[model samples]
Target: MVTRRLVLSAGVALATAQLSAAKVFFREHFNDEGWRERWTVPTKWKSESELGEWGWTVGKWHGGDESNKGIQTSQDSRFYGIIAPLDEPFTQDGDLVVQFSVKLEKALDCGGAYIKLLGGEVDMDSFGGDMPYQVMFGPDICGSGNARTHVIFHYAPKNENLLAKTDVRVERDRLTHVYTLHVKADATYEVYIDQTSVRAGRLEDDFAFLPPRQIPDPNVTKPEDWVDERRIRDPAAVKPDGWDDVPKTIPDADAEKPAEWDDAEDGEWEPAQIPNPDYQGPWRAPMIDNPDYKGEWEQPMIDNPDFKEDPLLYRRCDGCTHVGFELWQVTSGTIFDDIIVTDSLPEAFALAEEGWARWKDKEKAMWEEVSKKEKPEMPSFGDEGDDDLDEDMAAAMDEDWTKEEL
Candidate 1:
């Protein structure tokens, strides 16, 4: 009875374990095109303001200058400012994902993109000023001449300030690649570059927060409110530190130089274009989708098997290979694949490597292709499955089965 009870308990435990292991949740893709239509752009936010805020335009794609063909906005700045209402206020508990598509005519300096979440008051200038949130793809700076472009992921909280930046470069000249970000409220936040899991971590606790300021009184102007007179020590007197007391130097005799001085007869001095450092490609947010929940689905890699094998050959023939290359990530016993392609690999790699070197003085990994070889297949389970059973029966027969049958 005791042995039977123990066996029953063990069986029940094993059944429960199987049931738990079977439950799995695959990520959903969220679309930016659909999301943009659902959100509104705030007032006082001009489409193209004097402060160079034109990059904050809304809509699917707003074509820009000829030089930046296929770009939604100017290459000089980051594009799109999306303001949407959440059904429930964002907290540190729920999961959220944001994705989009971007292309570069050619990479530019300080040119990169990111998605910032704001829970409290959001100041666009500060990129989520006082919000308790994270940025999936944070801002990045492109190296001089690299044209590598791909999706990048930045895990929030942990990547607070400038340290939180990770990017995956895609093949050059590809358009409309998909990218995804997975953010769970309490658990680890993950960023998939293309579809590759590039980063995962907890939210950092040391976010900088400023004290709230009181609204200025409209009826009476305070000293600080009056811009011109606020700093006046006396109404009729100017302090030594005031602008009037400061020495203003006039141009000397030789100050009036030629507008095009020291030219080589052609024009102003043109610095030689420096090759882009490795891994300095511009980062883009790819597309996301969230259709009805399906059982543990996997996103297939947009195949470019001959990417490195025939770089120039495929770059001209296949646009997909030209635009980006795929990436792979292993998480929770599952593998996720993504792609990164830019207009230029040699350029983007140089830029990414340069940026990495600036932050940390480490040498970038040299690109190499491992030789592939074929191997013989091993026997399947069916071929060997009956061996153990046959051996056991032979032993039993030798010991007593023959005598019993006789």
Candidate 2:
């Protein structure tokens, strides 16, 4: 029989394994040309003397040789390597895992290659150059005093070093040694050297000591406490008396009535005089009011939570009306087309609510049934009587009780 303690221990072990398994999402293998357009070599890495013209290199998998003709060199005789762009955006809730194979040539100084994950910039050169979130790996590859291979972590653009000077070494001329870097969207980063995990910590506070300003672009904005004047519109431009004002009109109550007016007519009657009922003189149909409408008639409510608060909803022009509502599930990566569209919002909400209600009810009923079921009685240790009333005395008492003699 399985004990409760044993079951609980198994559950805890499974949970721990799940947490560790959730570390990375979406790994990109540069085996093809899909990511070629997203990366670029920055000027710092492009200059000579450091690696000078030899900053970066890439090609089809081959045995070690810097002179291999297939290896592509960086532009301007500097680090010549390709940068690949991610197909999707990374958010604070996402995780990225980057793995690469590097075999350094004997002449190649242990400078090691750099892999950077960045946001807020679409282009590679503009990525770490100035952005809100970035992670650099160099100091972690190289060990202290080794100065050859390093894995570094830099946060918030401007290359403000969150971590630096951690030296890493690989077995010399090792073929295709794989390195993995795990980064959480919440500013937590970890480095894995070979198969072992190393250096895991929060990025924001650790990298706070570096210089706040590094990018030289005067036009680019930095993350700071200052207000964004561009986002704030002039109050006068949006005032009621300005563009949004409604023209004043005083109605004359005694104005001439319509030609079909009749005093005796009431309750859904047709006009008294049919001016052109069968004449077919461009008849206009009656308009139906949307039953679910809440706000102004010109602007309808958007039921989708993702787009409800979007500014585009409030910028609609006057006199525009929502004909109907649609729920769309978009599928294509490069197109605005949707895979499915539904006509009713309430139907979706009702279905979701019903599913949740049934699930909760079933769980409650199962637990209640388990509690009510009978359990085996435990042996009682309440009495310690008549140890000596055994053997012959017990036999004589049993016979007397059977014969009704005492």
TM-scores, all candidates, are: 0.30, 0.34
Residue 38's lDDT within candidate 1 is 39
TM-score of model 1 (CA atoms) = 0.30
User: After superposition, which runs of candidate 1 have C-alpha atoms over 4 Å from their true positions?
Assistant: 1-37, 42-48, 51-71, 74-80, 105-109, 121-133, 136-139, 144-162, 165-174, 184-186, 200-406
Q: Candidate 1: deviation at residue 175, Å?
A: 2.6
Off by over 4 Å in 2: 1-26, 33-77, 94-96, 105-107, 123-133, 139-149, 157-159, 165-172, 184-189, 200-406
Q: Best by lDDT, which number?
A: 2
User: TM-score of the candidate numbered 2?
Assistant: 0.34
The local distance difference test score of each candidate is 0.31, 0.34
State the lDDT of candidate 2 residue by residue for 1-406, as single tens digits: 4698899999888766654454322233223343243234444433335222222233222332333221223322232323334444434334444443343321122233444454443444432223332444432222223333344443322435444333444433312333445555554555554435656665433344333323334444544543333333333343233422322333343456666766578434332342322233332343444343343222223333222122121111112111100011110000000001111222222222333223434434543453354242322223568453334423322221222211
Cα lDDT for residue 327, candidate 1: 14
